[model samples]
Target: MFCFQCEQTAHVNGQAGCASTKGVCGKDETTADLQDLLIYQLKGIGQLSERLRALGKPDQAADSFTLYALFTTLTNVNFNRAVFTGLIAEAARIRDRLRDALAAAGGDVSGLSAAVSFQPATDLPGLLAQANIASVRAGLDLVGEDVIGLRALILYGLKGVAAYAHHAEVLGEARDEIYAGVAHALAFLATDPDDINALLAEALALGRLNFTVMEVLDAANTGRFGAPVPTQVLTTPVAGKAILVSGHDLRDLHNILEATKDKGINVYTHGEMLPAHGYPKLHAYPHLVGNYGTAWQNQQQEFAAFPGPIVMTSNCLIEPQPAYRNRIFTAGPVGWPGIRHIQNDDYAQVIQAAQAMPGFAEAAPAKTIQVGFARETVLGAAETVINAVKSGDIRHFFLIGGCDGAAPGRNYYTDFADHAPKDTMLLTLGCGKYRFNMHDHGEVAGLPRLLDVGQCNDTYSAIQIATALANAFGCGVNDLPLTLVVSWFEQKAAAVLLTLLALGVRNVRLGPSLPAFLTPTLLNVLVEKFGVQPITTAEADIQAALTRQAA
Candidate 1:
């Protein structure tokens, strides 16, 4: 039950992973073992799906299952052992069905590997027995830590890709290429390549794959919700019955809004859902109130104090505390052991909970925060931005974004954003912005100095904006007066980092700490090849980024 895929892995006496009875995220050994077994079966499904694709007989259901299954394995997404055990069995069933179909189609399956031929145990003890062999570091003695670390990097990156793709798929947006890419990557892991160089290259390949997933998601979101527009969201609580939707799933929020509309209940966005207020279609809902809290890490405290029911739509859910466990709901791939989960997107139970509970009795004073500066909204005023740069009115562009966590040294990001020059524009995305989004950075040349560019998956929007700025300035993205200071917390952030490196984007700073899975040798390789640097102090990093322009 060794897991080090997130920023908060157990680090004791020079140890770097969560191999004890319970993970730092509250995932116990049994749940972790079940998750490993499920992932192992998913790899088998991936192998079969890849083979089926080669025969020109790809199964859409298998593809969707693979994506959702990988997403559930992400940090803080799902901790329900029963849910994982069922999925493991389903994966084996899909693999066997696909194998039979291939044989019926005259494709030879006799030479296929054991991953395609082996059967999974039906009981918990038997499954745990098989998990030791299926674990991520199964052959660590032979392949060594470097190879194992690189493999974990690739696998974690793919998990992030699957999460973003899953969000898009539920919104009626998916690509066969993405499905194929996911299957190929998962199957690649099944073979356990020991070559460090090859494994590193595959990590970059997963990065490029994540870029495609992010693009599909960007289109799906904007196409369905309309491009994000600049809007001021009220932060103060309103006097009414309410339901708070958290995590990154816009579809869930949209459906909940529809269900609770005109029902005397107000819906507010929390965590990464804060950006939903920027979407024109979602913003049109009158009862869709405002953002309730900061990032996912603070949910234990925030959810406890909130006066209504809460719904976690996707990843980054911590263990639900007893105070709010019964009232909080899980949707999509998100789950906890005993918490109520919303299947089929039905919100009747959640609505009832909100109706049954005491909501805000009196309206708090209105306080506003600006959001929705996605690519479209920013590019609509690109000429103004470009003109400011040309006239020396804008000194620099700083992309201070990524996932946030409870770890130390994260305060560097808050200080970095707050300390940036008044003439500089700070472009932010992901839940990390919660650290300083409320801090007033003022404006520059008629534009808000701080730009909130949607969620973490909306790194696509950040890329688009950067590319446009580069094109207008007649320079490469790196040559622009922009610096990427990314604060990573989980696999999704890892995938985004790989995307930046794969695209040859250089001099990006990543912190609060680098992934524990990355060995010192692998870290050196990243530093030398990609110009990736571990973040120092906010004052030093800000000065270094600004000084680069002078050179």
Candidate 2:
């Protein structure tokens, strides 16, 4: 049960990984083993799927399932061992189905590895025994740590890619390129190659695929919900029967809003869902109230204190606190052992729970923050931004966002955003914005200095904004007065980081700590090739970005 896919992974004796009975994120040993087994089987499914595709018999269902199964393995998304067990069996079924399809197409499967040809046991005990051989540790003894880390990077990056692609698929957007890419990567992992250069190139390939996944997601989001606009969202609670929808799933939130409409229930967003207020179609519901809490790490306290039911729409769900355990419901791939699960866009259970419980008794003091400065909104004011830069009213831009965690070093982002010069604009997204989005950076040239560019899911939007500004100024992104300060907690951030690197966008300041999955050797390679930097002090990095000439 060795895992280091997230920022908060445990450390012992200068090692960075979680290998105990339980992980830092509350992932128990059984669950961790099951996740590994799931990945192993997914690789098998991917092997079969890739071959089936090569034979001109691609199965969209199998391809989509591979993405979704990978997504469920992401940190903080699912911890129910039973769910993983079921997924493992389902993976076996899918693998066999694909195998049969390949055979029907007259493709040879004689020389496949155990990952492609192994059988799954029907019971948990038997499955755990099967999983023991497939744990991440299997490669450490063979390929060594450096090669193992390289493989983990590609595998985790693929998981992140699948997450974005899955989100886009939910929104009725998907491409064969993304599906095929996932299968190919999965199949690549199945072979367990030890070639360092090949693994590095594959990781970059995953990044390129993620870029397309993010674009499809961008189009899906804007196509369905329209581009976000600058709207002032009340951070204060509105007194009413309430349901707080967390995670980054807009489709789930929209459905909950539709079902709870006129039901005397107000819907508030938590975590990454805070940006939902910026979308026109979503915010049109008057009952869709303000954001209820901060980032995902605070959910225990926040979820318990919130006066009504809670719905987790996607990843970043922690184990439910006893106080709010029964009232919290899981939707999409998010899960906990006892939490009631919502299926097929159903909101009846969540709505009933909200109505059955006492909501906010009194309105909180009125406080508001503006959001929805996604690429379109920011670019709509392109001339103003350009003039501000030319007139020296705007000296620089900071993209200070990513996954937020409860780790100690996280306050750096808050301080960095707060201390940015008034002449500069800060573009923020993801839950990391919770650290300083509330801080008043004031406005520059009729635009807020602190721009909320939607959620981490909108990394594409952030990239687009930077690229547009670069085009306007006639320079590459790295040659612009823009810097990326990121805090990553899970695989989604990993995928985004890879996208930035693959785009040759260099000098990204990543913390609260370097990824455990990145051996120093691999990190040095990135440093040499991409100039990726571990974050220093907020003051120091800020000064460097402001004064350093862009390369």
True-structure Cα RMSD, model 2: 1.1
> What TM-score does each of the candidates earn?
0.99, 0.98
Tens digit per residue, CA lDDT, model 1, 337-407: 88888988789999999999989999999999999999988999999999999999999999999999999
- Candidate 2 TM-score, true structure as reference: 0.98
Clashing residue pairs in candidate 2 are none
Candidate 2, run of 10 with poorest lDDT: 542-551
- The lDDT of each candidate is 0.91, 0.89
Where does model 2 exceed 4 Å of error? none
Mark the 10 consecutive residues where model 1 has the least summed lDDT.
Answer: 108-117
Candidate 1 — which residues are off by over 4 angstroms? 108-111
The total number of steric clashes, by the backbone 3 Å criterion, in model 2 comes to: 0
